[model samples]
Target chain A: MPAANGNNAGILKSGHDARLLSRSNKCGNTSGLAPGYVQTNLIVLPSRYASDFRLLCARNTVPCPLVAESATPGHWGKIKSHLLGIDGETLAKGLDIRRDAPKYNVYVDGKLHRQDCEDIVTEWTDDHVAFLIGCSFSFETALADAGLTPTHTARGRNVPMYRTTLPLCAAGVFRDSTYVVSMRSYPASEVERVRDITRPFASTHGEPVAWGWDALERLGIRDIDSPQWGDAPLAKIDGKPLSSFKNNEAEVPVFWGCGVTPQEAVMRANLEGVVMAHSPGHMILLDTLDVETIRKF
Target chain B: MPAANGNNAGILKSGHDARLLSRSNKCGNTSGLAPGYVQTNLIVLPSRYASDFRLLCARNTVPCPLVAESATPGHWGKIKSHLLGIDGETLAKGLDIRRDAPKYNVYVDGKLHRQDCEDIVTEWTDDHVAFLIGCSFSFETALADAGLTPTHTARGRNVPMYRTTLPLCAAGVFRDSTYVVSMRSYPASEVERVRDITRPFASTHGEPVAWGWDALERLGIRDIDSPQWGDAPLAKIDGKPLSSFKNNEAEVPVFWGCGVTPQEAVMRANLEGVVMAHSPGHMILLDTLDVETIRKF
Candidate 1:
């Protein structure tokens, strides 16, 4: 890994730059790393599970906005963006999917067999199909552009995610899984504006699924500090717990359908063999801009 | 049939009002009838052709935005709109689909078997599934709201439609069919404004697929006044042939993906059974407002 305090301070210039940086680095969280680019959540499953998983995405689009997928099993050189007629580079070329993301998770029989592996080239086989699912990071540029910076971004941590009671519409062999969401606390006054700003990014998660503390609890999120995936919300900036930040009444927690929902659903399936996914916060960056993903309204 | 010179002069107050009128009147064109409601192109095929047809829509979204489909074959109680999380009347309820549209068309062996039939409830079967395709009429309200009225609407005639050389993305048996488009003319100076106003209704065929008189001929159109479907453009509105209107250097034709493209594709499929569609100028009115369909940005 590069030195902790050098010119490569987290953020990179573009998607192409980020990909080059990612190929050389050890596994790390990808949040706030590549701005204004389409970052995707990766899921690799056998051809047997591909149809069922596709149905799962179609039935539950909010939590799983299907972006691109392997045209055929083991064929991963190029994939087309599902969004039509957008004027931009829809194809990501000349990269290794096995090592493009900063980190990866390998699940065997519904259990985590390997966590944060740098690459999975050896594990890949001809039966494998890679699905590039849309990530919330694709719309973060809009949020930042609107001046509603996410609390996690301000604190330099991964977004906090939670499991919820929202049941997913099931498909064959993929049944009985609840929804998952990521939280971003913004000033209470900005909730409507936040929803309005993010509303056009439908290819991503679009608008907030829930907006207040009670709404979050109603969805079965019991704790605000703890998260099911990614890093816990950082309470301190310099060295002390953020007593003032935690008690700020003007701030409210907003939730959007998280990419973790699909990952969790695949894990719950517990297929006969193994499936692959991006480790929490490590996403595949596409060449397209975040604005290009916005619905043209 | 109600007298054409009565209080109801083409337009109705609301969706409920329009439906009540539609029920009592003999088959007629629906152009400019219901001012602000969503209208749809209807298509019904056997369950055997449903999956492939669905893929066809998913692939060619610009030409075929699948709004809603029968939940099960011949089961048409309710359909959740494909659009995600818009706060509006997304559900169409309690209406008999077979008799609702102003006129119906029956097809057999890829040929027009009947035209302008009032209803086809007797021909309905449990094996058939209905698809409600988005109509360009959904975005016409935005055009009028922006002070750019459609030429066909102003002249009180059906929009001119043409079969084009642009081929659709083939799916299963539904192959080798070219595209069909609806044409509307506006002042040459207003093309940009027209494009901007209608860009939001992505569920409808978003914006103009092409904008200019040359684009019409390039798509293999020999006569702008004559159309393959719907009424021929009435060049002479008041008196004399529209030599003046035709020569007006300011006006130009704009083309959009017409609902006819999918209907044409289904016909070309020539499945060994009957197919049903809304007649050329007739449409099914939905209980949602026109603005509700606009992709929020």
Candidate 2:
């Protein structure tokens, strides 16, 4: 069993055991686990909805980039291997998927119902299928590596997310929905560098879809007061905001694709059966590194 | 038929006829036809050797990228569609596989007999399969667009090629062959710019595999004389050796993987049958744009 430290260093020490820990519920939030390793958003659905979902992913690749798909029906281990590279022997080894996640949000008919890992397993059906979409955390690490600290990471915020006007391509039961974007602040000068660095991380949302000071306002976001998830980053200069003045050298906000797109799609589908996902900040830590994952296919 | 002239004006003037013209062998070389479109290098082999060849391509992606494989046995058109995005209807409408190339080199038992296109159709076997790898023309155009003209293009010579000491990863019959590299000379100042521009052209051999003047000589390519493929570039400025006469300026030589790797591999396989390829300069123009092809996959 791997220790549940929520940092990249701790994740690296755990190695393959981290996957087991994630499956076993021994490890907690995957926010910082398996540093430099690729983490993916999970989406499992019935076989009937697979083709449409595949098309959906293809059309909206930026948000829901399809890394790999299940090879056959009822072959959970193979599908998991395609995504996590876990073999049958490993699957037979038995993983505690339910307890690993700190929390799991269950959706029924597009409505959210809190369910721990154990409850979800009972909902699983023989026809259920899954998808592992790319997440922004990989690219965020890249940004941090480049010496630009993402505001959310520094402040321990959830990373502010917004529903944007950019509509997704509709596929079968998956209807068009505004893309969800997560924002982080940085010095204006770092935006281009950030863009260039993130461009190559295509599997992890690639480059930003939009950028500008008024972008939030354009998207009908007002006040910037209330945030949907995570704490709002404090705009400060030299570790402090002026008591009665605006600072000109504060960080500027930038946004990237969040991994919630497919989850949102799954929720919208309102399918009768079950769908599976990693709990918030809890990801299946694979043996594959981010660069290797990008290079393999 | 498409005009043989290079650039968009020629493509616009030729339109759909370009396809027919390419097939008619009216276009001497597919180099300039369908500007902005991708041009592919073709390789065909029997199914018995398909897996080996596929592995070979995967191993030596820079030189023998496996863009598309036959979806099933006896389905040549399906492979073409996947690679060129041309529909089955378009292919059935009629494609003169034979005589399509301005020229085709027939190889048997690892030796080139003569350059001709007639052998393609008669050579086709029920078990034969084909692959379309990327060519350098696309990258050359991209470099030119970025204001970095390749010296070979400017000097009106085939890109200088040499078999290097660098051994490509072997797969099956493709083993122990040195990488064939195309060299271009650029000022030291432009090295970074050239690297930046060419790195994205991964399908077109990506960035240079190596750099340096004597780097080739160290690889056992001692004689700068007795050129391999193209005319020798001018090495003297005002009767003084160019490399040494430049005062304080430095000139660096760069090398890229040549398209000849696959052709070389086919010949080395010594398989008894017909193998098809676009003539030295002739190529299969694809509907995909260069940018899209090179875009981060």
Candidate 3:
């Protein structure tokens, strides 16, 4: 049996076990919790917009690589290799999706309505479809194992994300949106190796799409310290923005397609419907191995 | 300009030109016509069944790798780089999808209403959505260029396809269907080379799923000479069913996911709504190259 710590008793020793730890400890971040297992971004939309959302993910594969999805409107456990359901070998008995995650963000008519909640069982409906998107957390373990921990991870801060000038390929009613990218600065010399390490994780945004400070200007980033979501870099010497660390001389910021892009697109589309997502940094841990998640079918 | 041997004029010297050639010559097989351009399988379903079909394609990507789709109901050429309308450069001034293909197969309520027809204009409705699935014809050119021509192409016969025991992952009302695979035979020594050559064209069912005579038994294939669709192998020596060839001493049978699979599933589902598809050897030729078709976002 895999070792379990914190509140976890039956689950594998992973970021998932740590997430259970966070839930009991009143901590919200699920990032860096499950190491080898896949972590997924969550988005629940009404069945009316499900097809369009599916099309959106297919068109924008890099930013929105679908991991598993609800087979029917009301079905949650139908994901073939799920972690939190009864049909497959589940993490817990009698699992309820609405109450499982560390935190939830509720949106009404595409506007942020609730910031953080322990559970959203009252908000969910029978006509809702849940989508699981592979998250950057799935690939961070590989990067760390290769001795290239992301700068944000090393500094104990959430990864910085920015909206880019790159427009997404439109699908159906989902339209008029730009890609959102997460940034992690690395030594300029190690950029190629960093790309190589992350290249196989295509389901997790694959390799960095842009590199260096020039990329910041190209992607229209005015400041590196202030992100659209998540905590800022650790060091801000005398009110001046630096990299994630205090001494950031050799680092160059690299950008990867962010999981927040679909939510951003949903908010921009402004559809007259409710969409729910996991709070930023709070993701759903899955049973699938990271290698299995990236395998070509 | 590329050479145009058959009745092709004004069109670029590629699949588009051959489709024009087939249009005039009343020819159905587009097996060896265009060398570099992409060829696609066609399936048109009512908008009511469109979402389920899209999900089906997503779940069973190997057999139903979607190349392009109608932007909306009743639209034909909204694909970003299409070959059938005015928005982008198209084949003819006013291309009608109903009358374009060399032959059409009309299925009414999951029953074959017509085997072959020059045009499907009489059966078309405004609510239909057209789907273009990438076909193996897109990658055969590369195999030939690598000096590993498939036996079906060498003998000028339509590729033999079989219904396999491999059950497709179900989605929505589309259920209870098995995978359809097309077979080609080559020397045992060249299987790896063949796999290498076709691996890049993932949209067109990259690489064989099974190989050798044992694969036939594993897939529950009782007969190799008699197939569900397309012409039988060119020769059957001594009335013995050979491996897509006569002398089977060194030949090894290789199976690829067939584009005809979605149609098989539709037929099995026994959907009340009629679905339309191109006749087996008559495909829709697109303007995009095989390389462009396989490119990731």
Candidate 4:
């Protein structure tokens, strides 16, 4: 890891930059890197699960918006240039999926074998197919641009996440997956502004699934103080780990579809072979797709 | 048949109105009917083809945007309430699929056996499933609202359609299908405005697939005057079949995904069982979805 302070800040500008950092194994996590470009959540699975996973994303597009997928198993160098959104304009430039991401979480027989492995060169087999999903981080950049800065960003902590009771439309052997949402808090008065800015990025997470105090309850979230991952919700400090910085004011919690959803679904299925994903908060940046006008009308 | 003067011109106000007219065999077609509501293209097939058809629509979203589908074979009472778009809001109020559309085309072993059948109560079988698709006519109203009236609409003729060389992504049994586009002519100066107005209606064929003179040649449409369906291209005619309105000034032809695509594909498959479709111009109107902002971002 870099020092307690960010040693590699303001320099990571493109996919090549991030890929170089990860290839060197010097990058910690990929938050706040390549601010204006598109980043994807990666998932490499066996060929047997490809058809079911395709149907899964199609049936439940909101939470599991598919950007592109490999044309053939084990061929991680390219994707099918679907003419939807920016795939047609982007997929021409190709990169090695194994080393492009800052890190990879290898799951063996439905359990995480390792996290932050820099590259998956050895774990990759001839039957693996890579799927790159649209990330909420694309719209998060939009949120910061629109002046609704998320609380976690200001506090310098990762966005809080929770696995909710909101079930996904299942397909084939992947029949037991539910929705997982990333949370950002803003004042109650600015929820509409926050919604409008994010709703345009349809390929990304799009609009807030729910907001306000009752929002968590509606989604069957039990505790606000303790999130499943990331830092705690903004509140009176009672000796909690917030990485310093106080006087925070964001009050209304807004939830959007998390990119980790497909990751969770594939993990829960627990197929006999290997599955790969980008480490949470770490992403693979793309060359195309302007963050401001990704799906903006 | 209705008179040449349009006997039921202003009476089509809702799904209820169109259903009544078709039930009595009085409605000619459903264009310009129930002006503000959503209209759908209907397709019914054997249960054996449902899984493949679902995959086809999922892959080729541009030409085959799925609206809702039957819950069971021969049971069209309700659709899965996917919270995306308007399926959740509209599926509550249901209607009889057998009598909802203005006309049904019965396809027997890949050949059109009959057209303009009022109802298919006798043809209903437990093994048949229905699929409703989005139509481009929904955006036609948006164009007129933005003051870019279609040339064919002003001429008292159906929109011209042509079979293109643009191939659709094949799934299972739907291999030999190409795209069929519905045409509406506009001026060169107003093409951008026309695109801006219609692009947001994503479910309703979104925007024009191609435009300008070279567009027809790109799609392998050799003869501009000879369309496989609907009226001919807007031109100075010597003795062609068009209703009397001569000052037609709309010059440029714009193409959008025609609803007839799925019908043509299913017919080409040449399955052993019966296949059903809505007549090219006739449709079924729905109770929800405001066309002005289906996907206005």
Highest lDDT among the candidates is held by which one?
Answer: 1
lDDT of 1 by residue, A119-143 (tens): 7787888888888888897777788
Model 3: lDDT to the true structure? 0.69
Colliding residue pairs in candidate 1: none
What lDDT does model 1 reach?
Answer: 0.72
The list of candidate 1 runs beyond 4 A from truth reads A1-10, A86-89, A234-249, B1-297
What's the distance in Å from true for residue B229, model 1? 40
Candidate 4 differs from the real structure by a C-alpha RMSD in angstroms, to one decimal, of: 22.0
True contacts kept of each: 0.00, 0.00, 0.00, 0.00
TM-score of chain A of 1: 0.89
| Poorest lDDT segment (10 consecutive residues) of candidate 2 chain A | A240-249
- TM-score for candidate 4: 0.53
Worst lDDT window (10 residues) for model 4 chain B? B238-247
Residue B181, model 1: Cα distance from true site in angstroms: 37
Model 3 chain A is weakest, by summed lDDT over 10 consecutive residues, at: A1-10
Q: Residue B3, candidate 1: how far off, in angstroms?
A: 32
Looking at model 3, residue B5 earns an lDDT score of 20
TM-score for each model: 0.52, 0.49, 0.51, 0.53
- Candidate 3: TM of chain A? 0.84
On lDDT, the stronger of 2 and 3 is 3
lDDT: worst 10-residue window of model 2 chain B: B236-245
Model 1: CAPRI class: incorrect
